[model samples]
Target: GITLSGGQRQRLAIARALAVDPRILILDDATASVDATTEARIRLGLREAMKGRTTLIIAHRLSTIALADEIVVLDDGRIAARGTHDDLLETSVVYRDIYEHGLLERQFADAVEARGGRQPLEAAS
Candidate 1:
């Protein structure tokens, strides 16, 4: 087998757990280490693999978590909110925070790309 990076290892763990033919699989921050592209690929694979299996994913990265069937936001050891992405965005401040952060990050990336791949910081003042 080929050597794997931290993110690859996490994806492999998910794959391995899936190999058990589980009725339910809980992923605690599983995609934290992977980049958006890799995470997207993994999630696509997961969709195919989880057809009949239940999946519970825990993630701080809202982008990855957005694909979930339902989202449960926790705050201070309490259940702050639970719902779909749109619902949580409307009713949950914590979920809003996480979602906004991901949005801002995406916007920043787009803006940088708009500048012909030159990072703003790399430009002369």
Candidate 2:
């Protein structure tokens, strides 16, 4: 039996989806399993592949949907806000919270990496 890591499986799934060339693509946290670097590459490829298609991306990571034509922020299964990223950041508390949290996580990860993967004591507490 062959075993694939989560990132590998995600990339495979994305490839399969793109191969079908569907009129619409629904990606739910599609890049969640991959590291930021791999996710960036996938995003670039997806942008090219999705140029003529309608894409519905449900993602908590702001980077995943950064290039979207429209962003619909959902809160508690309801549409809380709808707009571009900047617009939501200004007008939607839900969107701002998500974005800020994600940003902080990335910053923390970066700090850990900068310190050779040593998490700060404060972070561990």
Candidate 3:
């Protein structure tokens, strides 16, 4: 039996999805299991792979959907705002909260890494 870690499973799932060549791609926190560095690399690949296709990415990590054509902020299961990243930052409190928290988390993780300490939450293996 083979046991795959969360990150491995995520990568495998992404690969399978890409292999299908679908017209519309829906990715729900596709890079959540990976670390920041790995997520950046995967984002680059995703950018290329997503070209010429409509991609709907549901991610709490702002970086994951930073380049989206349009962003929709949802609060309490309802759409609170809709716009680009910069736009939402100005008009959407929910989006700002999410962005600010993610920024703080990244900064904290970087500080820990710099001090030769592990992140509070380990990236999925």
Candidate 4:
């Protein structure tokens, strides 16, 4: 057995999924262990790997949530709304406000720095 960091473990699991070549895959908070930048890259790759397959992804990160073909916004364990990302943004005021104030952006910037990539932008006043 090997000790793996949270991100590494998550990546390994994804790799395992890809190796098996499943027809339907369900990922619940799959990338939650990784930082935003790494999660972004992994998801970018998954989009192609998961093409034509049924992938039920459950994630809190807006970046991950936005990738879904259809999104269901849940509040207090109840369905508040259901639609595509853009549709929810337009119709659900609560969802829109949450996205605007979410930590996903900041976490993304942190991930970029961790990879020695672009620096995060300064916070708005």
Candidate 5:
């Protein structure tokens, strides 16, 4: 038996879920314990697995939710608004606040433009 850290356990759980290859997958804050880089890598791997499969991701992290083709904003167990990221930004105050508060997903495009299209990795090294 191997002792796993919180992030490692989370990754194992995700792998176990995906290994089943179900048509629909549901996640509830699955990556909360992981660092940004690890989360990004997990998202990259999951992206391929998610194709043509229905995924219900219940996440407060905007970066995770932003990848969805459509977003459903839930308020108090009811649907508050549903739309694309751009659409929700215009029409939903709740969804917009998640970004405005700087808790998740910065205005990455503006930051990238400021750096003249160079990636963060390129800028760092």
Candidate 6:
């Protein structure tokens, strides 16, 4: 029996493809089911492995998409917007939605950090 999580299957597929040593790799909607941490690690590994090859990554996760040199957004099978991360974030609704969600998560984390270490309130003496 073969069992694999969606992300694992995707990564395995990628590894298998890489083993063939192709000049170009295309990943469509990869990393869709992996946890954030695991996804990040996989993305990092892909980045390293794609050093000189042309890689096409398709993902709904903004963090993954943001790493691309150029981002092409499609709507109804048409190119709605195309540019770098910052450019698309500024001009594309789809990109902006994803990027803003990521930003909000970061802001929440920063806010938690800014609160400093928490401590139990002292009882009346």
TM-score of each: 0.82, 0.94, 0.91, 0.79, 0.78, 0.74
Poorest stretch of ten by lDDT in candidate 6: 116-125
- The stretch of ten residues in a row with the least summed lDDT in candidate 3 is 115-124
| Clash number by candidate, in order | 0, 0, 0, 0, 0, 0
Of candidate 1, the 10-residue stretch with the lowest lDDT total is: 116-125
Question: Which one wins on TM-score?
Answer: 2
Residue-level lDDT of model 1, residues 39-64, one tens digit each, is: 88887887787788788888888766
Off by over 4 Å in 3: 118-125
lDDT of 1: 0.84
Candidate 4 colliding pairs: none
- At residue 56, give the lDDT of candidate 6: 91
Off by over 4 Å in 5: 103-125
TM-score leaderboard ranking: 2, 3, 1, 4, 5, 6
* lDDT by candidate, in order shown: 0.84, 0.91, 0.91, 0.83, 0.85, 0.80
Q: Per-residue error at 43 for model 4, in Å?
A: 1.2
Candidate 4 residue runs with Cα over 4 Å from true position: 103-125
- Please report, as a residue range, the 10-residue window in candidate 5 with the lowest summed lDDT: 102-111
Query: What TM-score does model 1 achieve against the real structure?
Result: 0.82
Which ten residues in a row are the worst by lDDT in model 4?
A: 116-125
lDDT of 5 by residue, 33-124 (tens): 99778989999998998998999998878788787999999888999999988899999998888768655245565566678987555747
Better of 1 and 5 by lDDT: 5
Q: Is candidate 4 or candidate 5 better by lDDT?
A: 5
